[model samples]
Target: MSDPTVGQLADVVERTGRLIAGITPEQWSDPTPCSEWDVRALVAHVVGGNALFAAALSGQTVTPGDYADSADRLLAAFRAPGALEKVVTVPFGEVPAPIALHLRLADLMVHGWDLAQATGQRADYPDDVVEQALAFSRSALPLVRKQDGPFAPSEPVDLDASALDRLAAFLGRKVG
Candidate 1:
């Protein structure tokens, strides 16, 4: 039986790829919500992250290629038999493969939003996918904040804000 998270990861990867492909030449230097990383840098970070996760899961060092290639490698690594059932040491620390999957999913989803926002595109990720990513972000936020990780402290959003908005805010991205 296939793990459902892998399917969700694939969907997020595909959506993120579309967002990357849509970036116009002029927008490559545009500032994203990530503060420090502009459009090009944000995409590079995501691609690098895919490579990192793929390497962790596959136990093989993998060089990151373009967004499509890196994303494909990540999906392949996760799809390997017993991959999700094994523990892996990602950059953050040793974690169950499933948690690592969620971490990557949430990262891609948020960065997809960032890319869309930077390029004036719509982030049309499915509601369920955003919700699942949001859930994972909520669970991981405390530890992330405590560790003084890359994410800033969670910003406040209205109670009725959209899940995407909430996710971005929770990840320390300002939501307008």
Candidate 2:
């Protein structure tokens, strides 16, 4: 049986890849909700993350490539036999492969929103994917924040805010 999480990860990668492909030349320098990273840097980070996760799963070093290539490598690695059952050492710490996958999914979800907000594009992420990412973020971010990790403290959002907006706010991005 295939891991359902892998499919979710692929869906996110495809959506984020589309967002990256849609970036206009002028918008490359636009500031993202990530604060320090502009559109170009943010895209680079996501691509690098894909490569990193692929390498972790495959036990082989992978140079950061273009978004589509990196995403392809990531999906291929995760689909490999026993990939999800192995433990991997990511930058933060050693974690189960499934945890790593969820981490990547949540990161891509929020970063995709950041890219969309920065470029004035619509973040048309699937509702189920957004919900899964949101659930993961809610459970994991508290520990990350305690370590003074990349995310800022969670900001307030309206109760009726969209899931994407809520996810962004939970990851410390201000939602209007």
Q: What is the lDDT of residue 167 in candidate 1?
A: 89
Per-candidate Cα lDDT values, in order, are: 0.87, 0.87
Candidate 1, superposed: residue stretches over 4 Å from native: 1-4
- Superposed model 2: Cα runs more than 4 Å off: 1-4
Question: Per-residue alpha-carbon lDDT of model 1 for 45-99, expressed as tens digits?
Answer: 9999999999999998869899989999999999999998999998778999988
Q: What is the alpha-carbon RMSD of candidate 2 to the true structure?
A: 2.2
lDDT value, residue 124 of candidate 1: 78
Clashes of 2: 0
Across residues 1-176, which tens digit of lDDT does each residue of candidate 2 receive? 12238888888899998899889999999999887899999999999999999999998896898998999999999999999999998877898998899889878988999999999888877777777777877876677676456778889999899998888898888999
Clashes of each: 0, 0
User: Roughly what TM-score does model 2 have, to 2 decimal places?
Assistant: 0.94
Candidate 2 has its poorest 10 consecutive residues by lDDT at: 1-10
The lDDT of model 1 is 0.87
Worst 10 residues of 1 by lDDT: 140-149
